[model samples]
Target: MDEVSPEETPSQKVPPWLFRAILTGAVALGGLYVLGWLIAELKMLIVIVLVSFFLSFALEPAVNRMERLGIRRGVGTGIMFLALLAAVGLFLWAIGTVLADQIGDFADDAPGYINDIEDWLEDTFDIEVDAQGLLDEFQEGGAVANLATRLADNLINLGATVLQVLFQILTIALFTFYLVAEGPKLRRNICSLLPAERQRQVLSIWNLAIDKTGGYIYSRLILAVISFLAHWLVFWLVGAPFPVPMAMWVGLISQFVPVIGTYIAGALPVIIGLLDQPSTGLAMLIAIVVYQQVENYLLQPKVTAHTMEIHVTVAFGSVIVGSLLLGAVGAVLALPAAATIQAFLASYLERHEVVQELEDAEAAQHPEREPLGDRLRQMLDRVFTPK
Candidate 1:
């Protein structure tokens, strides 16, 4: 190696403090980037934990009832968990079986259904259309084949996603058990984390969250039951095929999906009916529309009011936002979130003196601000005295 000149030496090239400062900045940036990624990746787990906590709270009433009947807390909790698991398993099996059968039937009759739809569209719109030509074009090119291949690939991907979800669900269940088991201690620990003055406020907020979540869950359960019965009766009376399974699916999915739930619930039955007969499809569609109106106008407000009194607009907006962010899980979560936010805002407005005074003044004078006492006195004096 050649000897370096003193001026060109690496040790003389940079200040130690400057180099250290640059290194520190780079390391800090890297650390922060890594932390952000970790948080994003772990968001799903955080959601799962939150959901589990809400479920645990919702089941508290039942657990307490069991305790009152002389069951131990642990035993009652175990029974509740088991019952939940069994119900879920049964529901999944039913839905899976129905969906599989329906998919197979749909596949078998797809060509005929396509032709029927094209004919109906042409007749209804008074426009001639060629269904066979379209099908031929689709088949002649590689597009149809590629689409089928992609569909198969998508099915595999869906299966993998389902398996992953199942794994996550098991993990959630395990975490939920621990959360429920140590609920009291966990609450105490949470309270301890705050200053003495803040502890009470924190505890009160916790209780409110629990109460709202529990009420929402209970209300949803009741709504699901009522929807199932209503749909079942309607479908049976209308002579719809697969009435029971369709009704059950409608009820369960509607409970989870908000606003457009009824529309989505009706899609399957209408499609199946169209495959068989146009008149029957129309009848089924009418039945769905009527039932949805009844539910929306009458049942929903009454049922929800009894639980958590969230406004319809708020509920709709929350579900839309939540679904945009987190899909089905978010939709399920949105109701409680809206209720909680509404409660907080209401409480805040109630506690604020300025807000209270403004509200009172507004009530007394429509679309006008009343004068303050001092201003009113000054006005009165000006009017009485020669100004």
Candidate 2:
């Protein structure tokens, strides 16, 4: 061995206790890694169960209604499930028809549309666009053509995705059927594991979650319908093709998606109108603005506050975090999750009655405090910190 120099050695030896702690931490970290790997492997299964949870809560009311009308609970659950399936099938058919029509129309008029766009550019901006030449270049085995070819090849992957979706749907349906049919029994079994007092709390949270989830889902549907009607009327008045489906798309997207959903939903129709004829997109834009004003100022806050009972800031923040976590699914789930937690906290958590009570208590030891305006401003500043 080489001779040890003073500077070459560690300043101090690690203690036996610290060594044991480090070893324990390393083992705990490895265990966490294994657990995470297992979770990833079961991601789809977990998602199906969670999705079933949401559906069970959302549909409990309808099933109960059917049961109240002299139907058995199991029978009522089955009927509701069938009705849900039918509705989904109908929606898919409508979307497929719209897609077919749009694709066919676009394919047929693509050349004329390109030429018209070029003409518009030349007339409006006094700048000639070689759109026709560009189109020709794209069709002649250039990079754009290769990209298109690749996209066409990738279309086959849709079949695999469809199969996976079908499997998930069947799994969720099976789970939901059992959940709705045996919800009371399931709750009882779950509550049996807890103390009597804790059971009451669990059941209370369960019922409240169901109410909030059902109300939220129904409210979104009603809002979607209203948006669809506005979109359809505006588009039909302007003689847009496939107005109904396009409007349906706008309504659903705007209602379900958070924050920028309205703009995204409105953009599609405007683009279609702009492509179809001049000034039509402007009329569509006007309709979107008017409807949004009516919805935001009048409809949304009332319906949402009635059901959601969440702060506006919290709602926005939840949507953003949810979207960041799980894309579209998180966005849809975010509001209900936040509402559930808010309700639970309101029910159980004790809140301070006074503003700055801690500061006030600490200030009692001091001789004098700041002026009221300064104190108020300071409190407000702390509450509303800048991003």
Candidate 3:
């Protein structure tokens, strides 16, 4: 027989299941890519929602109190918003007034300031310098002209930015209002989708978030007040101009803003101090540094422990992590978010008493140190007890 040609080898075929699996995996990967893109596009919207959600939680306690007093939730929310706006308006007015007055005073006394500076330079550095000549040269050298030109060029941009900020604020307000006013209904609808156990867990988490956010807000307010008082006293003693506004600026910015806020808040006062007198600036700087140390080491830990039930170190680390992830908003929200997480974890995680040997080993490592609980209690006692 002629060399039988082997039957043409049939091509190996992929199993149907394997082909389907590959197709499914490709689609899944494509879907994931699309999802990531969408998330990137909506990042700002997501952040706005988060901020509004937390704001609603922070205001819920006050709204509930108002509801108990026979106020409708809508009315209470509106009232709260109105009050917030009024407070903001009042602050702006006060700050504007202070600044305008200072500017006017400085204008009137410019010549005197120049003379004083000249005398100081002469006395301190023995440099016979004509300060007025330098001032004239500065005005004539096109520096001031360039500054004005730049401001003029960017005026439209500035205006647009302001409008954008206002729009965002309005959006946040609307979201917050709805969340607060319909909080109960929202909770009910959420619970409707879950089983009884899950509903309880959801509700518990909601309540926990509210408590933590509210606690964070209240504690920060308390700290702000303390900062204001301390700075106001220091400013007055040092005869710094606009002491009230300066103190308010420091207090609110330092307490409410996160990360670099303290530096920003302290800058204006120090700058003004330097302009008025170097010695005054030095004093203010020293006071600010001392106050920060005291707050960081003493006041912050105690207050946060009682209110947020968070350790300072954990709060700080959260802030850093939050800032890395979401910038300023993350930093601002870090404390409450951390507190809620910690509380939730504490409830779910099982606990066991430490073994005696481990305790003994720890004690041995720090033989002279008291138990952490005891040390904290003693510190609190010292702080709160009257002389």
Q: Find the 10 residues in a row with the least total lDDT in model 3.
A: 137-146
Candidates arranged by TM-score, highest first:
3, 2, 1
Structure candidate 3, residue pairs in collision: none
Candidate 1 lDDT, tens digit per residue, 1-387?
998788786674566699889999999999999998998999888788877877777777777788889998788889989999897787788777877887767655666766877989988997677777756634535455366677887997889999999988988888777777667788899888889879987776777777788888888888888888988898788777777877787887777667777678788878776665677788888987887788879988898888888877888889989888778778878888778778867776756356788888987888655669878998889999884
Q: After superposition, how far is residue 201 of candidate 3 from its true place, in Å?
A: 1.6
Model 3's alpha-carbon lDDT is 0.88
Candidate 2 whole-model C-alpha lDDT, 0 to 1: 0.84
At residue 272, candidate 1 shows an lDDT of 70
Query: What is the Cα-based lDDT of residue 26 in candidate 1?
Result: 100
Q: Rate the local accuracy (lDDT) of all candidates.
A: 0.79, 0.84, 0.88
Which of candidates 1 and 3 reaches a greater TM-score? 3
Is 1 or 2 the stronger prediction by TM-score?
A: 2
In candidate 3 the C-alpha lDDT for residue 5 amounts to 52
Cα lDDT tens digits, model 2, 1-387, are 889999998779667799889999999999999999998899778778877888999889888888889999999998888888897786678768976776667655766878877999889999888786767644557555576677778887977888989999999999988988999999999999999999999999998889888888888888899888888888899887678878887888898778878888888778777766758878888888988999988988778877766788998999999888767777888888888888888889898766698788877878586899999999999999986
Model 2, residue 24: displacement in angstroms? 5.2
Among all candidates shown, the one with the greatest lDDT: 3
